[model samples]
Target: MYELKEREMIFVFTGPHGAGRKTVAEMSGSTLGIKQVISCTTRPQRPTEVDGQDYHFITAEQFNEAQAKDEFIEVTRVNDYLYGIKNSDIEKIFKSSGSIYLILNRFGAETLQALYGDHVVRIFIYADRDTLEQRMRESGDSEELIATYLSHYEDEMAYREQCEHVFENVDLAHTVFDLTKTLDQYLNRNLLELD
Candidate 1:
């Protein structure tokens, strides 16, 4: 059976595209010494992103083959691309870290929550639509792709109520500070319960 160690936990970062979920997750994870479980995606890599660091960019065939082999713990299709987290990746992180974070969509977060129950913490981060669009534009996304992302914003925002924590990511530094503090409290509480 799959199980986390007493100190291990999974943090799922979820929100609409360009909501700063990845930024917040990375910043908080760095501050808290939590590793990030790099996910595999069939989307084309951006010029600024590193292949293995940002994501495991794979071909559609490769993604399908891995999914067929039951390698992914959760998989979701968004904007005509596939994204998933592999079971092995989580295990690999746990070998050296007590906690890990995953950048996921609403569906992916729900899947992990169902699988891990209390062991998974779901956090939803969001920004104003204008901010979101500007972020996407700054990231070099095409206008069409940005529009496609925005089209799903409402659906993504609707999931915020289901998350254990929600933050408006207008200011990155402040958001990261708040997130780190909250995560620390959660981890401490879990430790107390374990004892």
Candidate 2:
């Protein structure tokens, strides 16, 4: 007889690039002691990124092989590099009795929601187009890259209704405060409140 393991809820932060989703996800994960699910990518790791912490960097051949095995829940190509989330990663989180958090795009968020059903909490982070563009510039992105990134804002904003919550990343402290509260309520977790 197969005994089912208890499932831990997954919190997903998603939005257009330069929306500050990653910042919110990382902070919330750290505060709650939830692990941020590292994505796998075929792109070369940047000097600032550590393997397994930033991403599971792999060869293009390895990525294709995993794809052939239907191992990825979602995959996307960005700037000629492939990035994906493995189904096994989610299973690992469930097995460890810990929740998972991820910063993904809309497609990835939808895929996770489909796989996890109600266990998945989709948060669509956003800011005004001007604010996002300014943030991208402040982050040291080239003008061309900033333009390319914000071009998809409208399309991404269209997916906002698909998410469980919409968060505006205006003030960092306030944004994280709301995010923690929302996540705690959704997961029925008391990790945030010290009482």
Candidate 3:
């Protein structure tokens, strides 16, 4: 049988842009009573964003140093901006009173799965081409940027197997509820074993 450990199963989630991965992360964490480390990035924060909550803002030098120290479990460059998950932050979160989900991209998610396959669970969120395009438009994403991200993550039809769960986010309300149920069971069983 596939047994998930009692300490906590870390979830590394990835999806194509506009697939609502971020929202899913937040909701999943909330439903499971855990924290979600939003991740750090060199990308400029938008007007409505905050430093510590939205992301940990870092400079190129700081990012490179963090990588050199092996402080990040996964680091990837997107459009000349560096984004990463801090190893210490993840450790502290899980070691503390709550669990934490590491929100990731395709590149980062694959890395985490490979490195921590025994302790981490991976889920992939995908959308149909038309649905992806619609979500992009609804998010106020520019065509050029959307095109760049899609090409980077590959076509919506390309196959990926690292994920244990494949969720279609076109109709996100239903998908969100279903995902919450899935995560609840995972977290509940593990938490029980820990006690």
Candidate 3, residue 169: lDDT = 77
The worst-scoring run of ten residues by lDDT in candidate 3 lies at 186-195
Query: What lDDT is reached at residue 96 by model 1?
Result: 91
Q: Residues 115-193, candidate 2: write the lDDT tens digits.
A: 7788788999999999999988887878987888888889999999999999999998899988888888766666635
Of candidate 2, the 10-residue stretch with the lowest lDDT total is: 1-10
Off by over 4 Å in 2: 1-7, 191-195
| Comparing 2 and 3 on TM-score, the stronger one | 2
For candidate 1, lDDT tens digit of each residue in 111-184?
99999988999999999999999999998889999999999999999999999999999999989988888999
RMSD of 3: 5.0
What TM-score do all the candidates reach, one by one?
0.93, 0.88, 0.84
Per-residue accuracy of model 3 over 66-173 as CA lDDT, tens digit each:
889888867888888999988777766766644567777767877877776756777788776667778777777788977887775564335346577888876767
Q: Model-by-model lDDT, in order?
A: 0.91, 0.84, 0.73
Q: Say which prediction, candidate 1 or candidate 3, comes out ahead on lDDT.
A: 1
Model 3 lDDT at residue 85: 87
* Candidate 2 colliding pairs, count: 0
Candidate 2 lands at a TM-score of 0.88
Can you rank all candidates by lDDT, best first? 1, 2, 3
